[model samples]
Target: MTMTMTMTRSLTGAMAAELTSLRDRVLDAAVVCVDRGGLGRISLEDVAAQASVARATIYRHFPGGRDQLIREAVDREVGRFWRDLAVSVRHLDGIEARLVAGLVEARARLEGHALLQRLLRQEPGDIVSVLAESGPAVYEVLATYLEDLLSIERLRDGVDRREAAEYLARLVVSHISVPGGWDLGDEPAVRRLVRRQFLAGVIDGIEPDR
Candidate 1:
C-alpha cells in the first residue's frame, strides 16, 4: 500500500482500540459513581475523575451528555446481569427450581450489588428508567430457561412460563427500586420470602393446586 494508506490504516486501528478502552472506562466510572453517591449525585466530573479521563472524553463517547452516559452505564450493567443469569440457570433441572433459583439469584445479586445497593439506599427512584428498559431482556432469559424445564415436564403442564418469568422479573425489579433504607438486615429474609412466594405461585399455577 502507499505511505498515506498505511498511515491511515494504523490510525484507524489505534482509534478503534482507544474507543473500546474509553467505553470500558466510562462504564467502570459509572459503577463507581453509583456506588459512592447514587445516580442523582453522580457528576460528570466524578465519572471523569474515576475513569482517569478528561471530562470531554466522556462527551466524545456519549454525546447525549450525563443522562446518556448514565443510561449507557445502566444498560451495560443490565447486560451483565442477563449474562450472569443465563450462565447460572444452565443445567438446572426443574422449572420450579430454575424459576426460584433465578429469581432469588437475581434479587440477591441486584440488591446486593455495591453500586445498585448504594443507589437504592440513597436516590431510590433515579434508576427506574434504566431498570425498566432492561426488564424485557431479563424476561427473555427467564423464558428460555423455563421452556427447557417445562419441556421436560419438570414443571406444571399448564404454566404460562413466559408470563410467569416476566412477572417475577418485574417483581424483582420493583422490589429493588424501592428504598429499603439500607437496613440490609432484612436482605436475606426478603430474598427467602421472594423465592418462597415465587415458587409457590408457580406450583399453584401448574394444575389442581390453582
Candidate 2:
C-alpha cells in the first residue's frame, strides 16, 4: 500500500509538470501564430500545428479550446514582458541607471512585438482590453518591485514607497506606449528622461543636463 501510494504521488507530480509544459508550449505557439497572422486569422488547428501537437491535445490542455488558448497566450506574453523588463535592469548599478535601461528595453520590446503592433493597428480593442485586464495586477507587481526605493537616499522627501512606485509605474506604462519627445532607443535621451522627468519627481537631487 505504501509503495503504491508513493508511486501514485510521483505519477501525479509528473503529470502536473507535463501539463504545465504543454501549456507553456501551446502559449508560445499561439503567440507565434498571432504574430504571423493576426488573431482573427488563426485557429486552434493553426496553434496545434505550430506546437506540433494535435487539436485534441490542445483541447485537453485548454478546455475552452481556441478562446482559452488565445486569452492565455495574451496573458502569458504580458507576464513575459514584465519578467523580461525586470531582468533587463537587474544588473545595473543604480536606480536611475536601471530605470533608464528599463525604459529603453521596455519600449523596444513593446514596439518590437509584431502581434501587439498589428493588434494596435487593426484590432485596437482586443489589445486594449487585455492591457486593461492586466493593468492592476501589473501595478501591484511594479509596486512590490519598486520597494527597493524605500532604502535609497534619493527618494524625494515625504514620498511613501507605494505612492512613488505607483506614480512611476503609471508614468512608465504611459510613456512607453506614447513617448512623445524622448527617444527611448537612445541611451542618453532615456538617461535625461530619467533624470529630468522621473527622478526629478521622486528623487531629491536634480542635475540640469541636456
Candidate 3:
C-alpha cells in the first residue's frame, strides 16, 4: 500500500510538471502572437495556432481567457524586470548608482520587451488599468528591495532613502507606461540623468543646511 501511494505521488508530480511545461508553451505562443500583430490582433484561436495546441488546451490553462492571459504575460514580464534589477543591484556599491542603474536598465529592457512596447503605445488604456489594479504588488516588492539596499549601501548621510527610492521606482515605471518617454538615447545617458536629477536632487534637497 505504501509503494502504491509513493508511485501515485510520483506520477502526480510528473504530470504537474508536464502541465506546467504546456502552459508555458501557450504563454510563449501568446507572446509571439502579440509581438507579431499586437494584442488586438491576437485571439484564442491565434494563440492555439501559434502554440500548435488545441483551443481547449489553451483555455484549460488560462480559464480567464484573453484578459487574464495578457495580465499573466504582463506579470511575468514584470517579475523578470524585478529579478534582473535585483541582480544588477548586487554588483553596484552606492545607493545612488544602484537606483540609477536599476531604472536605466529597466528602460533598455522595456524597449525590447514586445508586450511592454505595445502597452506603452497602442493600448495605453489597458496598461493604465493594469497599473492601477496591480501597482500595489509592484510597490511592495520595490519597497522591500529598497529597504535592504539602503541598509547595505549606507547611502549618504543626508539622503531620505525611502522617498528617493520611491521616486526613482515610480519614475522608471512611468517611463515604461509611455513609449519613447526617455529621450536618453543610451543607457549611460539614462544613468547620468537619473543619478544627477532624481538621486542627487533628493539627497541635496533633504539636507538640513538646504
Point to the candidate with the largest TM-score.
2
Superposing all C-alpha atoms, what RMSD in Å does each candidate have to the true structure? 5.8, 2.5, 4.3
- Alpha carbon lDDT at 60, candidate 3: 80
**Every model's TM-score:** 0.65, 0.85, 0.73
Name every residue pair that clashes in candidate 1. none
For 1-210, candidate 3 gives per-residue lDDT tens digits of 999999999999999999988988888888888888876667999989989999988778899999878788767766777888779777887666676666666666767776666666897776768657668878778766766666655455666777767776676567654535456446666666665655556544323221
Q: Which stretches of candidate 2 lie above 4 Å from their native place? A: 1-9, 208-210
Model 2 TM-score is 0.85
lDDT of 1 by residue, 117-164 (tens): 666666667776667776677667656655555455544456686666
lDDT of each: 0.68, 0.82, 0.72
Clashing pairs in 2: none
Question: lDDT of candidate 1?
Answer: 0.68
Q: 2 or 3: which has the higher TM-score?
A: 2
Q: Which ten residues in a row have the lowest lDDT in candidate 1?
A: 176-185
Compose the digit string of candidate 2's lDDT tens values, residues 44-115.
Answer: 888999999999999887999877878788777788889988988889877787788888999998889876
- Descending-lDDT candidate ranking: 2, 3, 1
Candidate 3: TM-score? 0.73
Off by over 4 Å in 1: 1-18, 148-210
